[model samples]
Target: LSVVQDQIDDLKISLNISLRIVLIGKTGSGKSSSGNAVLGWSEFKSDLSQTSVTKLCQKAQGRVEGRRVEVVDTPGLFDSTMSHHEVNEEMLKCISLLAPGPHVFLLVLQIGRFTPEEKETLNLIMKAFGKDAQKFTIILFTHGDKLEDYGLSLEEFIQKKCDDSCKKLISDCGNRCHVFNNKEKDTERKYIQVRGLIKKIDDVVRANGGGCYTNEMLQEMKRKMEEMEEKFKQEMQKMQQRMEEQRDENEKVLQERDNELKELKTNIKRERTLREEEQKNCNLFFHNITIIGPYFQKCAKMNQSFAQK
Candidate 1:
């Protein structure tokens, strides 16, 4: 009975693992600051130049409402004045190592200026990931002080800049977006809001990745393999078509030669038959003719026949 009870307890403990939330955005988006805020400690390095603070992913493990929360900080991605495509590629490599897979995407941004570049970054993220991204994403806008003086709410700001791309991203993320001011005094309130966001994202994580958040890596690899297979198949089809066309051309040439051979054989047979018929007619005429004359007359007749005939 004790052993059975121990197994039951183990199952309960396994059911309560913390969720992994990954922070992604351009440099100076305040990801490190936001991570410090979330973890309630200055464990991660923050306050770097506009280029980037977090060169690699740094993880901070913490507790909120009796559940463990993992915060993954990443470097800036696709900053026109800052990072390059190589940088983004490197960050993906880092993400693969650090988080393996993440249940939530915390996109840090400044409130006062939702620049076109920032919007584009979000679009890029969606394009890279695919529809699965919708399950585990929440927008976390930093620099809330910039919004204090502004009268418009976050939804209003999004609506003002609504396009098909932005609309689709919002819709895919389950209409989940949050704005947090790192410098604000009511940080616990923001934490509660963020806590809810984590829970929501966790539900998606369990549903999509077989309770393993790192399944994105597997899915990405699978997608690449499928693309390669399709390309290979297309090339094989082209090769087969070329071979068929060549075979048809070769067959046509052989058929023409065969026809010419048949015609030549027919002409030879007709000429041979004509020659035999003429020989038979000449033999009959020679047999039917009778000549008895003097040698001189015969010789003259034969000479004349030879000359005339």
Candidate 2:
């Protein structure tokens, strides 16, 4: 019983090993289809149109071969139709979805369809994922039927047909590659390929000391966001301070205006009193003059009358 319990504990430890994978590519490079294949179901929307279908980062989780698997399907990273700003916004979403970080990045490519558009796809991937991304990346090729039809293996195709840029991309990814045929009706083959891909990822994780891929770019982004938050707080404090100062200044001006108004009212009252006093004095003088003039006139008339007598 003790041995059985120990085995159970070991199994639990193995089961707890989680694998986080992020899929990236251009529009219609079979990113969604590859994600569906990896999940062993049609959890993601896959189409063959030239336009982009997945507009955001979508995550799906399931158990694969006793290991927990989480896949994040991101929008096309190098869609020419999308502006740089739009691509950047989507890339940030992808990074956020992979939070903490991703263990592997599956760069999907369609076999026999490597065009100039695809050539620049790697540059975009590196730009988005950072320089150290190649260490944690795997080149996943879709449309395996093309290779089967041509009777050539992925190795042969890469050696004989791939351009300099494609070869360089494969070399950058440590030559790690896997092929998948979503259109294949063989369930057994699909399962085998998915298992093989997972094994490859496990080997990569082991090689990297069981640590996920992280780069200066991601760290810089986090740093910038922190700095931005601090800056915003400082700016808000400054704005509040300015507003308070303005309020104080306005209050002082209002107080000064009120004081001036009160002084003007007092001056007006004093002037009015002075005017009233002057009017009263003038009236008294006129009244005295009238009384004196009448008395003088009567005296003069009496003198003239006595002389005539």
Candidate 3:
């Protein structure tokens, strides 16, 4: 019994050390661009030349502000030229890169083009990715400019345009939604979004294993499953007790994140207003300068006439 217990302890430690992240989206939705954005290096080819060139899995590795950020750009599904089986094969091939499971699925989508075809394709994403996938999905929307132009916050636009099916699909993974505008060119925004993704991944791990996992769990060993589940309950109780005691601290952390997001939105709004005011002042200055130049020239001509008289 002692030896058996020792092995169980060892298995749990191994499971906690591994991290994997996979990227999925339709072609031209900016998966490759976002991948480069996350990795902070243009490791993958991002071309908009209307070609189906991504034949297989491409992986990029980097340190995202201290976290090991690994990204795999998978060949997109539902290509007009490819058959369903081909798409499935390519998707599975991508999954093979991150073997057992990925902590998060970054499902990229376009700004204003969530069409019926895309809707059907979105359903296929769930099927190919896996069932019970909501527990590990994040809806990443691209095109920040449009949302800002519409005077809609990311939260508001998601509430309005990101429909129930989209909600159910991603919320299964963890209610993680990110809107990325390719044109915005802000590195900090990308970092912030990636940080939130990592946070959701932590939540998924905690919820699933109760802070205990192992290769045996990965292998789906039934005997180990029972033992782990039982052990998980005791550990969960301790965590719950700690959480209950420190509920206020946890709330404070969440409140801080809310405040940060509000400040980001506020800053964007302030910048837009400043640009409009600057343009207004620039036009006014140029107009007055033009009129004053002509007036001075006329005054000089009148002085000449008076002197000649």
The CA lDDT of each predicted structure is 0.68, 0.81, 0.68
lDDT of 2 by residue, 1-309 (tens): 966755664454354457789998878889998998888898999889988888878899777876778889888866667786677667657656765678888989999888787777667766666566778889999998898788899899899888889998898789999988878888898899899988888767765656676545577745776798899999999999999999999999999999999999999999999999999999999999898998989999999999999
Candidate 3: residue pairs that collide: 134-172, 134-173, 135-172, 135-173, 136-173, 137-173, 144-181
lDDT of 3 by residue, 1-309 (tens): 956754554455334444566777777777788787777778888766445546577877877556566677877656667777777667656555665556666777777767555566546655555444445556777766799887898878767877876656555546667776766567787677667656655655555542422323334444554688889999999999998879988899899999999999999999999999999999999999998999999999999999999
Error of 3 at 68 (Å): 1.7
For model 2, give the 10-residue run with minimal summed lDDT.
8-17
Q: Which ten residues in a row have the lowest lDDT in candidate 3?
A: 210-219
**Candidate 1: TM-score?**
0.59
Taking the candidates one at a time, how many backbone clashes does each contain? Answer: 0, 0, 7
By TM-score, the candidates rank as 2, 1, 3
Off by over 4 Å in 2: 1-16, 214-217, 220-309
- TM-score for each model: 0.59, 0.65, 0.57
Candidate 3 overall lDDT versus native: 0.68
